[model samples]
Target: MPVRIGGLASGMDIDGIVSDLMKAERTRTDKVTQEKTLLEWTRKAYTDVNKLFAEFILRTRESFGLTDSSSGFLVNQSVRGLKWIRRATVGDVGIADVSARAGAANGANELTVTQLAANWSAASSDGISAAGQSRSNLASQFGLTDEDVVHLTISTGTGTKEQKVQITIENGMASVIKTSYGAGEDGEDSVISLLSGKDISDLSLKELTRQINRADIGVTASYEESIDRFFLQTNQTGAENTVSFSDE
Candidate 1:
């Protein structure tokens, strides 16, 4: 390119005119570049919208179990089917609550509750200890002797499903008496000592209750200090569930 020296011979602002022309050309080029960038952004937004529509269509087809060859997509065969909007209603909300799933039977179903189940429980008829008596002195109240061995069998369940847990007390300590059955005959009984070497005076009702609960023989034993009595109950609540205590 040849360099042109202006304003030397023309005595006019020739260099300023050429600079203004170049500025106008740069402005036009910048406008074209901005338009191109805006077009690319618009194309990208349309592509994203198309992808979302495609995903929604695929999920709808999969939900209705429709294949590519299916002519139309209708949930449960018909658009206005009652199965699509199946709902359950209870007559008395306070008594019971009901819920219905999609495609459930449309009809009034009756439910009647006759009785409620309850757990079997037994409590001492008379207070074992006097009011305000210390719980640790409960053994003395029972008149337990070192030579005396008290056997208590707690039987649960009915018929052949019956289970027995025999508790034997000696020297104020209670233990689970495990018996072995050999060929339809009663075998030797083994004693699993719970509180060994504990004297009658040293034994507490609270301690005995803890030992019985720890045994996990389907029976819960608790001593009420206020009433001064022992309460025994089965862990489950049903007619078949029973807690029978046999003192032999």
Candidate 2:
């Protein structure tokens, strides 16, 4: 005879009771599985965080290499490691670049970008001097009349502080002469526009230029006949080079 089972003498459903008991056990196993999945996700998050920190440390090391004079600033290897974007520098990419390195000193550095260092320039109101045509009379060539003065004052480290030089014309002529031509001449103004006490008298424009260059005033006055333009500029760059004048 086979083994007698369930609901018989007891009038109870033994199969249904055993099935419900197994389901309760299954619930416990399922809870454990979900917890294990959550733990794996947390481990992945921590791994990603550690990776970010490692990358930051690598960049910091590169920065240090650039700043250390022994390594040489902006070396190709160090700059490449820092990952400098081309956009960090201002102005034309083909012309300029910018970067930084570690420094021994600690102070706030002020970066002022006033209009790029440029020469003081002005165009003649009239086209008196044109390009390709040499004029001996710089006075008329530069649109100068009876009382126009080219006042050039040099206030820079590379020049003399007491320099209040002036270039002028008289009787439609001027030349760089070696003497107090008008420095203290009779009936002359105390400060005649003669450059460095040198008298410039009725000389051809070319000869006059040769003489002016000999003055050693740390400046050059050029007249481009092709463009019919005359310009005066100091021999330097940056804010220190302040060459002031009038377009007279």
Question: Candidate 1 — which residues are off by over 4 angstroms?
Answer: 1-104, 130-134, 158-162, 171-173, 177-193
Name the 10 consecutive residues with the lowest summed lDDT in model 2.
154-163
Instruction: List model 1 lDDT by residue over 131-186, tens digit each.
Output: 45456654666666677888787666643355566666776665654332221335
The alpha-carbon deviation from the true structure for residue 230 of candidate 1, after best TM-score superposition, in angstroms, is 1.5
Judge candidate 2 at residue 129 and give its lDDT.
56
lDDT for position 235 in model 2: 63
- Tens digits of per-residue lDDT for model 2, 185-221: 5834233333333323334455555545555455566
TM-score of 2: 0.34
lDDT of each: 0.69, 0.52
User: Native-vs-model 1 lDDT?
Assistant: 0.69
